[model samples]
Target: MFGLKESEIATLITAVSVEGGGDLDRVSIENRFARATWSGLAEPGDRLAGRAIQQLGAARALSAVVEHWNTERFAAELSADGDPVAGDDMRQAIDRWMPRLKSDTALIALRQAARFGARLLIPDDELWPERLNDLDWHAPSALWVRGTDAALAGIVDGIALVGARAATGYGEHITMEASAGLVDRGYTIVSGAAYGIDGMAHRAALASHGLTVAFLAGGVDRFYPSGHDSLLTRIVENGAVISELPCGSPPTKWRFLQRNRLIAAASLATIVLEAGWRSGSLNTAGHAAALGRPLGAVPGPVTSAASAGCHRLIRDYDAVCVTNPDQMAELAPLVEREIDVSEIDSELRISSATPGSEVSAENVDTVGARSPETTRLIDALSARSARTADDIAARSGLAITAVRAHLGLLELDGRVTETGRGWKRVAVAKPETSRVFRSPSTDSE
Candidate 1:
């Protein structure tokens, strides 16, 4: 009906239906086409478009826009069905939507997407991430994906690692470590396909034989950061490249900001490996925090200006200071529960021993119970020399406050002792020895 022959319409419908693995009836096919049209007509994160599709079906919503129905008529029609979008907002939305409407735009977008081997994913698709629904009215109208469906679904267990495009060597190194670590821990990596930290995260994850998804600001067919063309191609082979924009659409500044929300929403948590004070990666962190997702920041040297954003998040935004993959994985509750409970229980028991008492090999078996932060803090301390909190913080790449807190816990656990110089790690029993401890529970034995 939108300037397409019957055969053309059937082809478009079949393309979407086949990718979705569904048998589309007449109504379902029209609805799929309407959503595809909406993807082209509206910008990403357009709440009015989301609301329209949610209230009226996609087909009815497309017809209302294409038929040039005025706001008053549209409102009245929708209001009869108890829709809440009937006032000045609806009028403004129509104004914004009308100028972009073209009879052939959607059909061309569909053809271009097919040519690029991309699939159109609507909300009904099984591979569609249910987490995106958390965006509410800002969720994408549809996703244009160029990769495996399994890789797309892998995003549910993914961690978003993002940072400044002009990343420093320190930033890239930390990104590599965190990305590979998370992958080893059974989490997928998610990031925008930009240069710097994002590229490194994807590369590291792929090198570790893990899936990584890149969310683009432009069409999936047109990967941004032309330098990463080869990187994006590899991701498409092993993972996925996805976006809300249809084929032929170029990336814009506004789209890039909107795209950050998807990166934040799709992952279990968001970690800023390295960022500057005004880096765009901070926008993704903001979205993650707003969505109530766990947020982590890797601390960098205080002298490095590139890490100012991470410090800001640690000091001001309540973002946890994560120095390694073990810490990063803790940001996701699912991963945290899997990695923490048993280990922490074991550590707590070991730490509860009498102060100055020797820990046994049995206690050493529970060494994994220590948090990564605690481990790093201990590593920064020396048994022969006491160091100040600031020195330890600098060595550990942790916030001073965090270093002090860990020191306090270690002091109570007898793992460290406060001296006139500062603090020193206590010489716990070596793991090679099988020194036994007498306990009331074991007295009968």
Candidate 2:
């Protein structure tokens, strides 16, 4: 752990992710290096390939062993010729695959975090959530933590609340109530820190002066959806904003989906207040179900599109249906506790607003280089599938020229790519059906 601050560790792992030298892919390599380093089996100077072989000598964790394999032609040539070093073929393979992570981006990012008072949390650490290991190789290398230890203390006793970005009135109400209730019951609320449900959950938790954690898809220092930057800052003041990615990492679509798994696994349970059939919240729920953890959804009206995902979970996936705080707590097997709601709400209102109009992708990047229109377009696109120039304009409520201009910017950024006729969000989920209102069938949206 020496000389390996959270950022340095991230850079080192990124260095190991060089691909195509052997059979190893960047993702697998990052996973292997993370496991080995945190397990105290590897150090910065040790020949990574050799350490990988040594770490896998037991053949116990097959996934770890398989990751270190090398498909280099040189190694194969040696093996085919019956070389003496064939006994150490795995080590030979590791050497053959050593040239991948020569880039300095990872290291630079690490330096930034160190300068910012941020720390990294790994699986073996006391703060690490054992549940995250359920993700196998897909689990994060380490969590970039920005906040007090208390924010992460009750991770095992937390619950995640996630839903649509353009949340309905009912959805917001449910998120606020659920967050407040859970906190009042002494449970930490974990969320993505996006707009709508995610924002409401964090705000409510803060209002109650309760522990809350925000798991970002980007770096600990980089808040995605720039609109929530201030909100995230507030959370980090008392709670935390964490990510598996290194500091200065951007919020790519793939990272968001990948991070959702962490949110689901880190908590004792997950709740969806409002989501459409294709919402990313479902992705988190899927991770929870795969881990065999208790899954819960607030039943929205069957007619309301935003409720589609929640309804699907209840009907098809057998998620526990909860309507209110009592029902939600019952699913978690908890006893009731009293709290001063007025004090928490009052404090939250006073501390919540920080003079930001909205959060957009322009500010989401660690670089803060994307424009506000580009952020708006991405936001609108993120809420739905491939949209035509006209469709984007209509849905985003922006001028046609503005939509076209933003779309062009997004395409150039590689955040979005053209899909056949129009354009589609790259590496991100298709947008969910928009919900204008909540129906009466469900008590709350």
Which candidate ranks first by TM-score, i.e. highest? Answer: 1
Instruction: State, as a TM-score between 0 and 1, how close model 2 is to the true structure.
Output: 0.60
Off by over 4 Å in 1: 16-22, 77-86, 335-445
RMSD (Å) of each candidate, 1 decimal: 21.3, 15.6
> Which lDDT tens digits does candidate 1 get at residues 9-117?
6687677552653567777677778888888777778777887887777889888988888888777766765656657867767765665676777788888888888
Report the number of backbone clashes for model 2. 6
Give every collision pair in model 1.
343-369
- lDDT per residue, candidate 2, 84-164, as tens digits? 244454453343223222234345655666666666565545677676766553455456778878888777668889887
**lDDT of every predicted structure (CA atoms):** 0.76, 0.60
TM-score of 1: 0.74
